[model samples]
Target: MVWRQHRIIRLNIVVLLYLMVCFVLCPVSAMTVSSPAEVHSVRGNAVTLTCTFTSTSRATSRMSVDWSYRPQTGGPPQAFFHFSSLAFPPQDGQFNGRVKWLGSPARGEASIQLLNASLSDNGTYTCSVRNPPDVHGSPTSQTVLTVTPKVPTVRFSDVAVLLAFILLPSAIITLALLGRMCCPPRDKSQTQGYHSPIEVTPGDEPGFKQINRKEKNMTCCDLYFLVWPFFFFCS
Candidate 1:
């Protein structure tokens, strides 16, 4: 009978422990943090590093957020931003006057914005959220940030070169085609002038014979020279 009573007491203790865990400890095990895996931004623009958290309890002023950055050159990470009841951005450093808190704990947002991003801002960033009684799961999340340099502006000289190489040739071809269509070439057969026969002597030069102009096959240039003298004398 004594052994039976001892077993009953052990069973009661186990039931009480299970009740305490279900009511008090389960909520703390539900806290979790999350962030984006990567973010891309251009230089001279604003970029946001978004972070969020899930908690079974309501947020309070005692909760805190911490943001840290690690340079690409490989070194220890540095804390650049912090928040509790108020924001605490770096006062004098790479992130001075450039980082702002745009988060609302009631809405589960813990995002931070960086203005006028530069190439030096490319690195890894970490966000940590800590709330009492709900810190069982991981409270830190990391993101890789890549800041691309701004593209160079086009210059007048480049535009001129492009026009010379591409636009000029295309314009010339178009104009040539328009000219051919508007002013068709004159027919060479219509311009063929009649030539009179010429008197010629053979090797002895004693006899004279008339040679046909068609047999001579005179070119246009020869006919022009022949007619130019006659025109000059008549004028």
Candidate 2:
């Protein structure tokens, strides 16, 4: 009987050891971070960070997920979210009135949306899951949240109107100046073959014809008037 009892005890120890090994090798049922390892948002805009997790256990609804922030410089983590009794606390200072839970917790959803984001929201965010003594302490998964300032854009219509108002007159003036410089007007008398008459010497009169002063004056005046149109056009 003594030998039998000893064998039974040894068998029980071996079985217990086997059970311990199995438990050690089994994976933990917990949430995991799956999306948005790095996220970006612009000031005055909305942003959503996503996290997906799965568990083999059936007590997922009873689990709690926590979201917190830790500076890259290292310090105590700041709490941004917590789930318990189906309630979440008011948003922290800069985030107040701008943060919201995306959906219900029972579905393993832990996404959060931030509204009217600002520069102060930049930090490292950590998501953790807890299910009490049945599981080990919640493991932390981190993401970097970066806030970028929005760039101002000019509308097409506004740009077109501005160009018309500011550049149109300047362009016209430039073209007029260029035209005047490139093609200058010639004197009318020279262009029309009208020249002042020269007086002939008494001895040389046989070779050249003499012109009357009145006729010469009249011809010069006519040529001047004829060239007036070209001068006016250039001006």
Candidate 3:
């Protein structure tokens, strides 16, 4: 019984080794494609349709890539790009002289560029890569691109309207401030005249000596000298 069990174990080991060798020799059929779900672009500009892929084996001359489009308005998909060992951009129809390849096959890229994108270019784009012998996982992916018209710029009329509503009021306020700073209004109290009543008494007057014929005969200077002393004494 021991001998029989030993033989059975050896046979099982041999079978496992054979299966491992077969798996190593055969090629795997697995691949994956990657792409953005959506893209946005302004009209009359360039846009890129990004795409990438992975495979169990490296790409070769036999590998192929194709890009197609479906209008946003709804329609059947149409081919606009092709690639094998070399790129084949579209040269007919709406895509004429507009499509360009911007991918590196050595890095497993299959992206493309569209020049002068327009409103008509807004649609769904599909990228398909087939690295033969790797055909298991999904090899195709899609992205939707939207092209919007450029917005209108500010016009002279718009600027005038803004000035009328915003700058005009601002100017008026500034002018009023400057007027206050440069030419302030006068105060009423400072400009008006004011007066107060005065009181006079007869006691302030000096007792004048009655002028006789002797004083009348005196000169003007002699009379002024006599009156000056009396004026000082009265004050």
True-vs-predicted CA distance for residue 55, candidate 2, Å: 1.4
Instruction: Name the better of 1 and 2 by lDDT.
Output: 1
CA lDDT, candidate 3, residue 125: 97
How many Å off is the CA of 228 in candidate 2?
27
Provide the clashing-pair count of each candidate structure. 0, 0, 0
CA deviation > 4 Å runs, candidate 1: 1-27, 153-235
Shift in Å, residue 4, candidate 1 = 26
CA lDDT scores, all candidates in order: 0.81, 0.66, 0.82
Query: Where is model 3 poorest over a 10-residue stretch in terms of lDDT?
Result: 205-214
Selected candidate, larger lDDT, 2 vs 3: 3
Q: What is the alpha-carbon lDDT for the whole of candidate 1?
A: 0.81
**TM-score of candidate 1 relative to the true fold:** 0.58
Model 3 lDDT, full chain set = 0.82
What ranking emerges by lDDT with the best candidate at the front?
3, 1, 2
- By summed lDDT, the worst window of 10 consecutive residues in model 2 runs over 206-215
